[model samples]
Target: MSGKITQSNNFIYTALALIALLISASLVNVMPEGILEYIIEGFTLLTFGVCILSLRFDKAWTRFMVSIIICWLAATLLYRLFAIEMLDYLILVLMMVFFWGTFRSIARQILFVGDVDTNKVIGSIVLFLLIGLIWSIIYILIIVVSPQAFNGVDGGPWRHNLSQLTYFSFVTLTTLGYGDISPRTPFAQVMVYMEAIAGVFYMAIVVASLVSAGLSQTKNSRE
Candidate 1:
């Protein structure tokens, strides 16, 4: 029982951290350039740390994530201090790695290893958010390489463009191409379509997981 409670708390904390990251990313537009950027980066790192903590079931896995986080943090600080464009790509790549790791961990718990409890249900939502975020990082990377990858985005620091890219990412993930932002390059187009496909299938996958969990619960109750 205590273990279950602890797992529940981890899920709740991770959920809250993800929410805060989303909010901070959304607010990047209104925030001014220099100091606020650092704050956002710090907040992002903190969210990543919380996510790593939520994976405490595996000490080795958690350690690996910490090392990635450390590398990401170092790259971020150097980018900020030196204003290096290359570091932007590095940071985005590191961020993507961490998010992908967390996404897989949460997905396994919710989809395969766990009962259909409230925490598992919330883990599904977290998985959805991770999908959006992971795609956003990919979009950001493409933009950093080819500034004209998308029609609606203007060239600037990735941080300044994060809000717009993130919005576009989720919009694409939900298959709601608002037409305000359109992917031009072949790579970007492919990613957009893939996200759309994932969005369509995500419901099917979650429903299947839930149904399986329900059946297992009924069987256990009978026993």
Candidate 2:
């Protein structure tokens, strides 16, 4: 049981590391654009790999999802290397599934557990980051379907657009509207508003849950 807990903690740490790397890459302008994008892509792949490892599922389901993720990752890489237009859609879909599964697993672990521990706290943070990632993919999908969904985002390679969308997603998630990236379409605006609400609600729920869990643990110890 202790070993299992340690593995879970490691998963959260890995996710946090990936989030930091992605944000750092986005903010740093010293590197050439192409090289920066390549680094970001590398981190993206690594994130997917870590997410797969972090997934908590029954054996059959685990095997199935892992197989699908592996196939999608391979196809996404091949299409990206060839500059295929499908790469954006592929990655968008892949991230949606990945974030959904990861969020569900982490939420379950944190909410259902009886004890409050470091892993639960870390999982809460991971959940927050995962929410931002999910919104980023949603933003990308909107842009893919309608290129004019956002203002201040230039029409360019999807990779560049993805990086920008990611930054925008986190900014929106944190409710730190810098006024630089605004949604032009109603659909985009709706998503941005939803993400902002989700960010607030998620934080509130996690704090409540953690506090309740901690109190329960203390009471149980006394009994």
Candidate 3:
């Protein structure tokens, strides 16, 4: 019974964690520099820890991955304490891997394994957010390498750029293309359009999955 409850609420937990992370990041603009940045970084780490707990599995490999994430998280926090610039890259790479793995797990669950429940439907939304986050990490990585990768963005710590990049990522994903944050580098431009394509395909696939789930439920009722 506890396991069933956990399964049902897993996505809810993950969604809330992601939302907290986003909110904290979005508030960075209002926050003063120096110590506040570290505070935000700490909050980000806390939310990520929650996400890891919520999405963890009993599988051996999953356990191993979780261990690695925990270690990375610890190291990131340590680096942040010491004011290490390298921590920026470390955190971005760690988050990218974590988001990608969570996306895969949720996609397999909702797209392949089961009938769509409310939680599963929410999982689809989580997948969309994960895509934005994954691309945001990519964009940040590019910015790290080339400060001029984006016209409007400065080459700052990934944490400082998190909100803008995340906003740009989702904007590009939805093909809204407000043009406020244009990609300057050729590779960054390529990534922007690719994210747009992915967003379109993701919407179509989600609609199809919902339709299929509805049909399957109806068939089961008839049976």
Model 1 backbone overlap count: 0
The candidate 1 region of ten consecutive residues with least summed lDDT is 1-10
Ranking by TM-score: 1, 3, 2
Report clash pairs, candidate 2.
none
As a whole number from 0 to 100, the lDDT of residue 68 in candidate 1 is 90
Residue 191 miss distance in model 2 (angstroms): 0.7
Error of 3 at 104 (Å): 1.0
Would you give me the overall lDDT of model 3?
Answer: 0.82
TM-score of each: 0.93, 0.85, 0.90
Candidate 2 lDDT over residue span 154-214, tens digit each: 7666656666888899899989999999999999999999999998898789888988998
Task: Give the clashing residue pairs of candidate 3, or none.
Answer: none
Query: What lDDT score is found at residue 122 in candidate 2?
Result: 74
Which RMSD values do the candidates have, in order?
A: 2.3, 3.0, 2.4
Number of the top candidate by TM-score?
A: 1
lDDT, candidate 2, residue 148? 90
Candidate 1 structure quality by residue, lDDT tens digits, 1-223: 2344367767776787888888887777577767668767877977987787777786767888889999998998898789888887898899899889888777877885657888788888888888998998888888878999999998787878878888898898888789999999999899999999999899789999899988998899999
